[model samples]
Target chain A: MSEARKDDTILDVKNLQTVFFTNSGLFRAVDDVSFNVRRGETLAIVGESGCGKSVTALSVMRLVPDPPGRVVGGTVTLEGTDLLSLDEAEMRKIRGNRMSMIFQEPMTSLNPVMRIGDQITEVLRLHQEMTSREAWAKAVEMLRLVRIPEPDRRAQEYPHQLSGGMRQRAMIAMALACRPALLIADEPTTALDVTIQAQILALIVDLQKTLGTGLILITHDLGVVAQTAQRVIVMYAGKKVEEAAVEDLFENPKHPYTRGLMASMPAVISFGAKTDARLNEIPGMVPSLTNLPPGCAFAPRCSLAIDRCRAEYPPLQEVDGDHFAACWRAAELVGAP
Target chain B: MTDQRPLLEVTDLVKHYAVRGGVLRRRVGTVHAVDGVSFSVAKGETLGLVGESGCGKSTVARSVLRLVEPSSGAIKLNGTDITGLSKAEMRPHRRSMQIVFQDPFASLNPRMTAGDIVGEPLGVHGLATGRAQQERVAELFGQVGLRADQMKNYPHQFSGGQRQRICIARALALGPSLIVCDEPVSALDVSIQAQVINLLIDLQRKNDFSYLFIAHDLAVVAHISHRVAVMYLGRIVEIADKTELFANPRHPYTQALLASVPVADPKAKKLAPMIDGDVPSPINPPSGCAFHTRCRYVMDRCKVERPTLVKAGGQHEVACWLNDGTGRAENS
Candidate 1:
């Protein structure tokens, strides 16, 4: 609590480096990642498949697997305590109690054999030390809070008995059973229907606000990021390419990759196409982690790449107040054509 | 949306798969997968079919390609009826129409190299042999943005986006007049998805082939499609031009579907969901209008009467009772 003001920081991560040791070489899944989440703030990590956004979140929770994936260097400080320094037993005590995670696939996350009621109550019993009757009652209450119709009846049903949306809501209820100080939702509604996705997203935002909980939403969908996150970190090839306030990021993107991403998205709301060919696709492929290009990893694909960019890696630096971008030509990219 | 010289016209397409149960394994009832769907794809035009998961949009695509035998309908390719043609009789007509499936990896044979995968169509149809097939395959590979040297590489050697490019080259082997794309880019990442979409658009412009693009993502569909069809529970609820459909969606379901899509601009005010409740079972669908169960403006009449696709404004059509009485307003 003395490390930083309680009002300023709820979770702070510094120099996070997650790597995978393969036969080919050492692959840095999350390279020197750093960020912080203020209390009750929603921070979204935006990236494509291999961008290490998920790895960063996993690194925060200390959930990185050992052999292949190891959080070699990082300080995931939560409420003045470094999660990385904590032992397995100490971390487990705080895992679902103070910090919880909701995975992308709800079907795979929840136990098929356990009833929805028991799942939620299991978290309550473990974290809060509630009695069987008290936990069961609270479990039903949480289900009702998530707006699951007939919560009492749904409590008895197994995971298979519920719809995709219902199963996800159950997972949310279980995650929020203890009112965790922080919630990590990795593509929470990607697998659900669009209609149901809206409902779930709205529910999560509302609940997080009501509980005053910090949230880290990991997703590839920019639309969802725009709608949900106050601030966003755009990751590319295991490195932070750009970070800015959501509004600033969308309105005037700094990095070429960020701009390309914004342009590539098909008109979500077709308000008379402004550009001839709306989608400006980023050419070439996302470079392999093992054999990344020399200097800037994105140099091979970057349209604005220069000789200097190809010779040395670009460090993520502040272009303006609270807006950071890792590109050699970040200054020149402002007011880009 | 019907233009001159329609390349593909599907009329009253219906496909009902049998559902069997009990000890005897007798036919209990029918799934009613695709019930009375109709659409036309003009020459060099793209017709996007969009709907929820179990909405039978894929069934319509499959039915049109004769991949699944329709219970009743007429499939006209270049104004020639190929509906009742037997396998041997329809063999040559297959050149006029082709299909590209969803999964890029699954669609391509793992054992076959990229060259073999794209060149197999030419060999199967006996259109070319040896050196000629090799030349055509190399040409297609280059056209789809893949290197000619990469042809020897197997499907597993390439990434998802490259594999999809190979699949597109395969679909283009015979220069088919119509290509049915069933969620081709759904599986790839957002960045890679754009490349594949751009490739498709470029190929369409150069080669000029009509497309029956089926997908659930309205944004992607609206980008490539000339006309868009919104399906719900085995029947299309609304059909209109891409801009018209996205601009002024008449049906409540269409409105909801469009609203459900989260806009990329965070500054915009959040759109509250118009309706709630999951899609009812297709096995035992609701009586009368299929969407009536979820429609916010549901009426007593909607429960008893099945609404048909009535002409609304311009080329737009809606199948809801709200648009029934005053729906038939001809613009011309």
Candidate 2:
């Protein structure tokens, strides 16, 4: 990569792997995943449950619980610094300062007993050299930035006292209080109503642009990905099955799994259109990550799977410029150009 | 085929729970869960009721099935008023109307086999027994696209989608004319959700049954329902044929909801401007029109007087003042 390109890249994750050990045996939760987020761009990691999307975010933050899970291999490079080699103290200083994350559920993520303003102020005090009064003022300002009405009054309220949408806004305020270069949000708007979800999504996108922050949005909703993300990564059973620009992936998905997922979603029909169409189904359930089939993880459910698919795992190959797929018959897939 | 006479009719359904406060537990206010709601289902039609949380859609479903007693209303099933029936008389009516809950895992008893769970309804109503019930159970299993052999396993052994199928099979065992499905496929994954939805549609075709399908997701509702009703607070804001409702929504709430749905197309146009505030509390809901707090076209009369459903055009009915000749002249 050129030096200028490296300078623009805010987060570069290469060959990432995370594994968990249970009584049933150890299984790879995230396997050989790689991606990069440029400054001011939104990169979405889309997948179903247990497909290791959330684990990938945790791995990047070095927040994976150690007893049963660990990031065994990979290099997470954040703005020219190798995060894996950093000591605990140094990593703590970098975290919530240069990078931050917003989890899916705000009710549990925020401290229940503490006032919302205090929670945001704690991050400012711990990470930056700010006095108590300065931190409190910055905390209220952050709430205002997230479009929370009555920021001064709302800052004194507890998490439970506020509505679901308000709690989520507070979470965003706390996450963005430091103005981090990289923001990782895992399904931030999944719990709210569609109207409220639109409000929250618009807020996130607007803030990202203003701050010039590189965003890593992890979600299972295809509609959200299409509306918000610039680039996309499709994951299936702990592997990156396809990667492409949002338009290219939706228009011409190269991987069979990606194509199946898109087909399964029932689109909101246009006005006055007939409603006789049945939604396309991917016949079988997602394979268990612990006891996966030998070759491709998705072979049992893929309609195009052949003998070769069951015999060998396909390597990620470039199907077109900046578009990649891990399917053995990527060229033969019906939507592939 | 839809019959001339509707299979179920719910008229002026009102259910309210009292809110107690202080040490004496005095009735301070009432939570208007479902207030004066009315709708009907044809013999084989599916009526999709959609709204956000705390909007009383679930309350309407529960009232229709008489699971929770409604404070006041008339529920007529097959031309018979079943609202005032005693528990003993309601037993026979229960066989004709069944309910499928959202969480399949919590609904089914873990200790019981899938076959026994499906056959429980038969035994309860004394519809079948012995080898006859076994044959009926196996038939229902096959009807729901589950293998007869898998019926011997417990609910734990089955996947989420399979558990939902078992719930459907149980509901089918009674041979009901109407089934109230409360977010049946919301718990499943996207791929599995599609499979279950297809199965439901196919089963409805074969059995010629009516469904009062309730969900918060509009796309799924658009695909499955013949007619759609949009609920706000505790009232139906708009009700119309699926095509008409989506194409020409008259109510401000209904229009805002349709515009809020994020389309799957990446290059799709920007989302329409959405409503600003959260749904108000149901306990002390906004007076007069419940949706005036967030409505964009609210007028002076809207805050003082409530609007009832009136025919806008064709079969479409809306409760907004704008559509009832009270607000804007262009809309009237």
- What DockQ, between 0 and 1, does each candidate earn? 0.60, 0.67
For all the models shown, what interface RMSD does each have?
2.0, 1.7
lDDT of 1 by residue, B99-133 (tens): 88899878988999999999999999999989999
Please tell me what DockQ candidate 1 reaches: 0.60
Question: Which 10-residue window in model 1 chain A sums to the lowest lDDT?
Answer: A269-278
Residues B282-321, candidate 2, lDDT per residue (tens digit)?
Answer: 9998988898999888888789889998888778888888
Give the candidate number with the greatest DockQ: 2
Give me the displacement of residue A298 in model 1, in angstroms. 1.0
Candidate 2 lDDT for residue A109: 96
Q: What is the TM-score of chain A alone in each candidate?
A: 0.96, 0.97
Give residue B71's lDDT in candidate 2 (0 to 100).
Answer: 95
Model 2 TM-score?
0.97
